[model samples]
Target: MTEDMKMDTVVALLRDQPDPINVLYAVSLMGLTKGLWKVSGAGSAGVTRAFGEDIWRLIKIGSTLLKADQDTSNPQKAMEFYDSYLIGRFNVADSMDYDVTDDSIEITVKNCRAHHYTDYLEENDVPRSVGCPLALGCAAMMEEVTGDPFIVDSIESKDGNSKIVLKKF
Candidate 1:
């Protein structure tokens, strides 16, 4: 497709709200900015993961990490890993719509850094500690900034370099 055509499509998709928040992508760490947006962190393509984050304050902490990648491991970068990389940074998104299903509350997050994820199985304790220091640090900063209780939904890896597509709630 032509550049204009592609942009037009993107604009249209962004404007079209799937749920309270909807996201879709074919790779390149695209975030659901309205519809789908490409994140610069990706080397080639991008992907996204859904969320059931119960703590709103922690959500802000994760966003702070994305804003600062290399500098996230500072002492202020939370005292944990999962909280930094997964909860604080990867789950960075505003204007969320909560989907209360029979099992979980679905919140859509697009263009999340899958590789940086580490909160898959962490203890419910403070002072984030996943593995990556930078990621953890970033999560710490996230808590300092956003004061929300953030949790991870899923950690998706590219596996072998394929396009990423996200589902809306």
Candidate 2:
């Protein structure tokens, strides 16, 4: 299965069920835990593509539901839903880690090879989470767990590892 297809399946399932625990478990089973190996084995989008798509979908759906509740003057219900279904089901690290299924995110390599790449997004002066998109999201998740602000802002221009530095509002 292609990674995008896999992601679409998961998203559809979640949208249908709306059960957070089951959603989390189902995500794990969808080869999210399998990481790069899974991508190379069965998915065509690679690890980054699959993981990024899944997380983005999850966030989009969750935000959509919350917004609907908010515009209806029932933010409490939405907040409660998030608290029970989302927050209670996964930790900050797990939430973000659960998002990205990259072997490199958790893998430890023995041999080292160095290649230099330019960092166009010079995240200086302004504080931004460090490392891969998932890792950075993980840090923001940690903040949320600790009752801190959701730190990492999702760059609309730069969602994943798309070597670009477009302005993100």
Candidate 3:
């Protein structure tokens, strides 16, 4: 297929699914691609893992691009980024709640897809700390965009829900 046809296929798939499903679909595709590359000896396992993680970092940065377009220091911008950008892209926007303080933002993902995805991995003996990179990438992107230190204050994914607290470093 031509590049345009491939893009059209991707667009169609995304449009047909809900955002959370899209996120999961994207994860599935990434896994399949990585697994195939490993089987084909396209790259070493470490290299492939790094490549996949770098791509995810870029995606996380891209998701926070809207925040860069706005005044990052604004509390409302922070809230919008949390609600619309971070949670929104995960297809959990409706299920997340956040509070914006003067120097911190706390968010609770009542039903995080990543948490469930991690559970699925653990059940199958896939040793991966799935949520940290995504969270840290977002924090890194936010810090870069806002010129303010941002750190993951706490992340609890073992429980039924994923709760993340981002605070100024």
Candidate 4:
């Protein structure tokens, strides 16, 4: 099938599913597939780490598509897109505190699923590979939508969280 037709098919499938089912299919499946890949071959751990980054890239791209019409260049609008589209759709963070001023937007995530997953992995003696680089997709998406330069600092804390700052380049 053509690319447009393929995309339409996927969209139709997702649109027909319940919201929770869509979340589980799109979000949980990414993590589950990565986990499975990590155990499938002798060198699969490295491949899984790279795949994690690609998976996040897809998520960010999907978010941009969802907010295609919003004026994301405005810091406030970008914040709205992040909150309304990303967080609202994914429900991945326990708390997402944000500040949007005339010049920039600062987002701090607390009690995120990745943080909890890292904790779980640690408890089970599984190696942790996903890191701030996985957030490249998010920063890139915000930059594209907002016409800003973005940076994500992976805070070295017990919880796996990052502080993302977006400002005009």
Candidate 5:
């Protein structure tokens, strides 16, 4: 099929879905990650790490644009907002559980759409630690809410769930 026809077909298929925008978003992120890996001639881990770093740098703009009216200064409140944002606005995950501490946020993402890309990378021998969008998004949200730079301390996936730890510095 022609490219336009192919896109039209995909769109038509997605139109009946509950959250078509999320599917598109997930596909775009996967394409971008794959493209960056190919064009940069970088290892999968390197590509994903760089992608995460870029997300960290750029996410402030997204956080600002998506900011809610409530005060999220408290870490617990911030996490609550992040959870709602992930399920409601981002539409990237089925659910999320978070634990907030003095300087860290541990987030478990259930049924994240980006797990497909992470699995693809792993099938090609990439490490599971390769960052996923959900991980980066959580770290970014924490940094934005706390007004402190938060780094992805660790990320692991198993059985369609991803656990991410963001540590403030």
Candidate 6:
């Protein structure tokens, strides 16, 4: 089978599985992204960016399967829901705190997997930010939940923690 066909089959299978299984697979997929970053050399940033876009696309697909039930009209509630969703769905961080306002969302994540993954990339001479897929994931989910577009304004990481800021667009 071709690569596209193989990926389609895998995605179909994943979509059919339980949430816990899908979360495990999603975490494993991060290792694949790391390996891709290592080999892409100067194109590592593009590869990482593509991975982030793919994450958004994948979440869009998953959201269709599991529609959100909460009333996420409030900006604060939407941001809080996205925070819990990230932790529950992808195990991206050990814990997350959010500061949400009318036009912005600031999140501080502790023990973030994306930070550690980017640290590995940095060690390999690839200078990539710590929030590629994580930032995109948040933006995509927030947009889906709140019906408002968001852009990643900033991402900073230190000592296994990351602070990401997303602005409404």
Q: Point out where model 2 deviates above 4 Å.
A: 1-45, 68-133, 136-169
Compose the digit string of candidate 4's lDDT tens values, residues 91-169: 6666667777654556677756544444333333343333333244445545656565554433333544756554544
**Highest TM-score among the candidates is held by which one?**
5
lDDT of 3 by residue, 110-169 (tens): 655444444433333333333334455545545555577676676666543766677787
- Give per-residue CA lDDT, model 5, range 1-169, as digits (tens): 3556435534543553457676677557656665665666435555565565565444444566867444467889867865666577666689999899759988888877566666654544444455476666556667666778776787788756888887996
Least well predicted 10-residue stretch by lDDT in candidate 1: 119-128
Question: The CA-based lDDT of model 3 is what?
Answer: 0.52
lDDT of all predictions: 0.30, 0.31, 0.52, 0.51, 0.65, 0.63
The candidate, 1 or 6, that scores higher on lDDT is: 6
Provide the clashing-pair count of each candidate structure: 38, 0, 0, 0, 0, 0
Q: Highest lDDT among the candidates is held by which one?
A: 5
Determine which window of 10 residues in candidate 5 has minimal summed lDDT: 8-17
lDDT by residue for model 6 (66-126), tens: 7844446777775666666667777877998888776777888898755544544444444
Q: Which is superior by lDDT, 4 or 6? A: 6
Candidates arranged by TM-score, highest first? 5, 6, 3, 4, 2, 1
Please list the residue runs of candidate 5 whose C-alpha ends up more than 4 Å from where it truly belongs after superposition: 1-28, 38-69, 125-131
RMSD of 6: 9.6
The TM-score values for the models, in the order shown, are: 0.19, 0.25, 0.47, 0.45, 0.62, 0.56
Cα lDDT for residue 26, candidate 4: 50
Q: What is the alpha-carbon RMSD of candidate 2 to the true structure?
A: 16.2
RMSD of model 4 against the true structure: 11.8
lDDT tens readout by residue for model 1, 1-169 = 3556435434544444343334243111222221222222221111211222223235445445556443434323332333344544445322222333222223333333332222211111111122212223232334433453233233232311112111211
Ranking of all candidate structures by their lDDT, best first: 5, 6, 3, 4, 2, 1
Query: For candidate 2, lDDT tens digit of each residue in 1-169?
Result: 4556445544555555456886665445333334433335423323433443455346437767666332212323322333243333333211211221111112111111100000111121111122233323333333333333332332221222221111111
Clashing pairs in 3: none
